[model samples]
Target chain A: MHSIILFAHGARDPEWARPLQRLREAVLARRPEADVRLAFLEFMTPSLPEAIDAAAAVGATDVAVVPVFLAQGGHVRRDVPAMLETACARHPALEIRLQPVLGEAQSVLDAMAEVVLAG
Target chain B: MHSIILFAHGARDPEWARPLQRLREAVLARRPEADVRLAFLEFMTPSLPEAIDAAAAVGATDVAVVPVFLAQGGHVRRDVPAMLETACARHPALEIRLQPVLGEAQSVLDAMAEVVLAG
Candidate 1:
């Protein structure tokens, strides 16, 4: 099975982190067979490298890194890649693929609209 | 002139909030004519309603609510809308439009890919 590593900008507040953790749960519920895990860029536990290593330990040769961020900004442009480079060097055999971020997706837009309209 | 209110999931750690505030600076730098303000859903200072009033006080008739969120989850689908509703009621004359969330945008995806590839 392909392993999925969901990456998010970690938040120190429990409130900020709750939604992301909920999203992780939603992802796994939809794909129970897939080996899914979460990692934070900073300010939280289970950093990307550690998550990748855990995935490798579970016999995952192909891993997909999904960034949970909004907008094309510095963290997405700089830090995440740096962390990924280290993970890749440590496990040269793993086929790592980076998925597009959750931005401008129709469902997501619809969801946003629903929220706004409700308000 | 249009007023832009950026809504972010605030973080307790100064690190997580810094990038978002930086983004606000970038947005302002690009559009100096627009009145841009930052608000948090929770865990930070300067909530959304306060930002809206500030914008109105500055003679902004058209206000855009931008969700600085990644997905179409509960906050985007529920809380934001509810907050908007209250704001709309309080400022009946204001022309408020909820902008499409920053998801799936090419630039954002590019940023995510850049980060991933760099790693």
Candidate 2:
């Protein structure tokens, strides 16, 4: 099975995860059986490594991490890669991949533009 | 005239602003005459206050601040509102309004979901 992890910069406020949860729901809506989860960087639960382990426990052989950030900053560029490297080392049997930050995607940019214009 | 500020959390790396720049470009494409600008919360030039000042100097009577964040955490809820209050106080003539974070928008959430599913 394949697992998709939505990596986000978590905040102290519990409600901050609302968007990430919605994103997870959206992903699951397309593939009901897909193993999708949300992981945080700080001030939240389920760090990236923990989330990956959870997926691995469920017989997931393929894991794709999508950073739900708007841009590739230090967090996306320096932080996530380092964590992924350790995750890869720990799960030799798992095929792990990192996708472009959501902000980098053209679709997301267009959507943000539309939101601003709608106002 | 109306000015739109695509406010984002900037990083130390200059390239980190690429996505925000793209967002600004997209907004301009929709409205060529739009006085759109990009401002950072930290580690970048043109802080929110500076952007608001510049807009006011350009004779913009209305300013809309759109935070490119995914959720309404402390940064979005407390920090931004505090800054906006100060900006409003600084420029009494300018009608400064804050919009929902980009991540809070349904279009953006859907786009993010589409991105993950496309893989």
The fnat of each candidate, in order, is 0.04, 0.92
Instruction: State the C-alpha lDDT per candidate.
Output: 0.69, 0.92
- Model 2: per-residue Cα lDDT over B52-97, one tens digit each: 9999999999999999888988887888999999999999989999
lDDT of 1 at A108: 43
Compared with the true structure, the alpha-carbon lDDT of candidate 2 equals 0.92
State the lDDT at B30 in candidate 1: 59
For this target, which candidate reaches the highest lDDT against the unseen true structure? 2
Task: Report the Cα lDDT for residue A2, model 1.
Answer: 82
How does candidate 2 fare on TM-score?
0.97
Q: Write the per-residue lDDT of candidate 1 for residues A12-61, one digit (tens) a residue.
A: 55455655655555666656687878788877768888999999999998
- For candidate 1, give the lDDT of residue A12: 55
lDDT for each residue of candidate 1 in B1-119, tens digit (9 for 90 to 100): 68888787775555556556655666666566768788888778688888888888889998988877764456766788888899899999998887755532334434443333333
